[model samples]
Target: MGRVAGKKVFITGGAQGLGACFGHMLADEGAKVALTDINGEGAKKTAAAINEKHPGAAIAIAHDVTKKDQWESALGEAAEAMGGISVLINNAGIGTAGSIETESYENWRLTHEIDVDSIFIGTQLAMPYLKDNQPGSIINISSVAGLIADGMMLSYNSAKAAVWMMSKSIALHCARSGYDIRCNSVHPVFTRTPIVDPLIALGGGGEEGEKKLVRQIPLKRLGEPEDVGYCILYLASDESRFVTASEFKIDGGITAQ
Candidate 1:
């Protein structure tokens, strides 16, 4: 249960959905977590619940990951709150569905700002704090769409692909500098989160839309928040010390096709 004990984690989008799940999983494992999201009130609620369970192990911050100033401030505040930051989970993203032929520049820009730019900003700002820990981990929540392409999800595909490549670049830099700060990306196909609610609604609400999506997955089921949460736990822990610059696909074997 205490896999990440003593580590201090700062997670972006740590208010609800998969982000809140990550906060819960980490806090339960004895890590003092800083939960930051645009929804400050929701993030506070999430942190309060975790603190109730773990006692003084969490804090919530208002954050807009696209803004550099906010990134810097959040990192500083979180580092102080937990003594030093050891793990940074760049989990804030948006999935915009549109074809390259029809997607507007504005839609594409906003998609990149949240899905791609945030990872860049968070990694740059969190690097020094992670270096201070000697061995730290940065988990970027990419998508299986990063590995493969779909005609309708143009912006989402582009953004996640950028995250996949960026993680490798950061991993190489950390290794050459001998910091032992591991960087990697986690790619999930689809899961039970608000992000997929629209699809479910389109599928007539409930499991119908998910059924169509899962047909593409060999596992024959959509993912749970805890599915991704457990993976983050492994990477945040020293168990994955030697694993860096790689991509972990939680796509229910979709990539196997």
Candidate 2:
């Protein structure tokens, strides 16, 4: 497809699942990818695998998205490796289950830091590069819980919801400033990623818990990683140049009900 042939993309949480899917999807389409994850070895493995498929198309970095110093270092290195930055995918996040009464302030703070603050840090650090690149995009991987609410997912829901709105704010700022940096959030429902494993464990830990989730989804099945990754790919590419300050729901039609 060569959708983003010359684009340079920096993705957090790029070692696996939707992150790895984004790498494979974009590399296959001819984009240069910098895959960053907390698990540095895993990131290296994922990047190596991508290079095997599309020689010289990828590099892996050991990045902790929450740290400002690491964000600066990662973007600097990624820019050097790929020539410049054209896109940022703030895909690193975690889910925590707890009602307001049960969730500790510690967990709340951590969830917001990982899921929400990292986006802010990454975007702020990457803005200069993105502005220079022009016609770039930022895809924040939020969740359907961001769009709605869940009794058991208070921390995760709040964090993702913050991301959802934060994306819009950044989009508006870029537009007003003529930065050509479109921003949008993707809301996926129960994608079969490791992120959902805790939920599975909380609900009987097997196909049964997953089935319960699928039952709520009209599509009657869990989403695949690519389902969200390609949607992100579109937002990352110029195809979405006219689309910003919006949310894409890869929720298997769940929100329709």
Candidate 3:
């Protein structure tokens, strides 16, 4: 049951959806988790819920990932609270859709600010702590959109692709520097998270909308949070100690085509 028995994990966007799901899942497997979100109260609630199930294993912090100052403060708080930070989960990101011609420059910039740039900040700030705690892991939540191109998702496509490449660069750097901190990116497709709400709404919402969203997925279903969480658990655990600089796709075989 203790897949990550001694891990001290700091997760961004932990207030709800995939972040909350990963927090609960990792804590269940014996990790002490620090849940940070822009929604301070929501992060507390999620942390409280986890503590209820796995007493004293979770904490909450108010963090705006895009801000350098906030990242420093939050990381310090987490390191102190958890005794040290062994894992960093860059799970906070937004979904954006617009063709290059239709997309505003503002949306493009905002998408990169949140989805791509935050990872850059988090990884840089967390590197010292991660290096201090050797054999650590950094999990960046990229998306299938990052691996595949879509004409309609201009900014999203650009941001996610940046995340994908950045992860590899970080991984290679850590390896060359002789650090035991492994870095990898996860690419999930059409997961049933709030991030996909806009897409669903565009499809008209409800079950019909969800179904329309899954048509491209060979499995014909949306990914459950647990699907990605389990993968993160492995990456966060020592089991994947030798695994780094790679991409893990939880896309139900959509990329197989």
Candidate 4:
């Protein structure tokens, strides 16, 4: 049997990249998948592709993670489409890399809204459904930058660190309240996503940046979307039943040394 058989999963920013990869992976494990993204067209395309491979397995919703109303609507749509959400993956986030002095207030606010506030909104919105289900899982996608500071990612790193702490807080709250839900965060470094492409361009196409980055990592390669997806699935599934209030680092040893 598939690991996530009969589970219902709701993912934000699921139109492409790591979120899309998670949707595909969970659906493959027999979970009913609902993908939500700000780019409605991209969400549709991703859902269609997944459905083609696993017919009738997924649905797509247009959602902006920063808005509470949109999150409510997305959750309602997901419940209607997939029955009930057993897994909530708050994978929607954005990054801005620049010296602290060079970053605008607007950029900082936007980064926090998407990267940190999204987690708060998603978790708060999902609580009712998750509590009703009991024994559900919530996974927040953080970043290695959350654990270790980078040269010019001040806002991004700050937001991610908040996300990491938020995950711990939620987990402790759930445990203390005797709710059967678990919360965790994943910290990954320089994954191959469009989010990092612009940053790489700032240093010349990621080649030089990647080489410099690899020197700090034993794995010596950028992480794939699937790598994060699998880690998310593990936490979402029963395999990680005892794991909560913890940060799982998928940084290829970047944080190890």
Give the top-scoring candidate (TM-score).
Answer: 3
Task: Give me the runs in candidate 2 sitting further than 4 Å from their true place.
Answer: none
- Alpha-carbon lDDT of model 4: 0.89
Candidate 3 clash pair list? none
Residue 34 shift from truth in candidate 3, angstroms? 0.5
* Distance from true location, Cα of 219 in model 1, Å: 1.0
* TM value for model 3: 0.98
Task: Report, for all candidates in order, the number of backbone clashes.
Answer: 0, 0, 0, 0
- Of candidate 1, the 10-residue stretch with the lowest lDDT total is 199-208
TM-score of predicted structure 1: 0.98
lDDT of each: 0.92, 0.92, 0.94, 0.89
Which lDDT tens digits does candidate 3 get at residues 1-257? 69999999999999999999999999999999999999999999999999999999999999999999999999999999999999999998888889978999999999999999999988999999999998989999999899899899999988988999999999999999999999999999988888889889989999989988899899999999999999999999999999999999999999889
Instruction: Show the colliding residue pairs in model 1.
Output: none
Task: Identify the runs in model 4 with alpha carbons over 4 angstroms from their true place.
Answer: 206-209
Residue range 203-238, candidate 4, lDDT tens digits: 566489667656677899888988887898798888
Among all candidates shown, the one with the greatest lDDT: 3
How close is every model to the real structure, measured as TM-score? 0.98, 0.98, 0.98, 0.96
Q: Write the per-residue lDDT of candidate 2 for residues 1-257, one digit (tens) a residue.
A: 68888999999999988999999999998899999999999999999999999999999999999899999999999999999999999999888889988999999999999999999989999999998898899999999999889898999999999999999999999999988899999999999889888777766789988887788898899999988878977888888889999999999899888
Per-residue lDDT for 43-134 in model 1, tens only? 99999999999999999999999999999999999999899999999998888889979999999999999999888878988888998986
Model 2 reaches what TM-score against the true structure? 0.98
Error of 3 at 71 (Å): 0.4
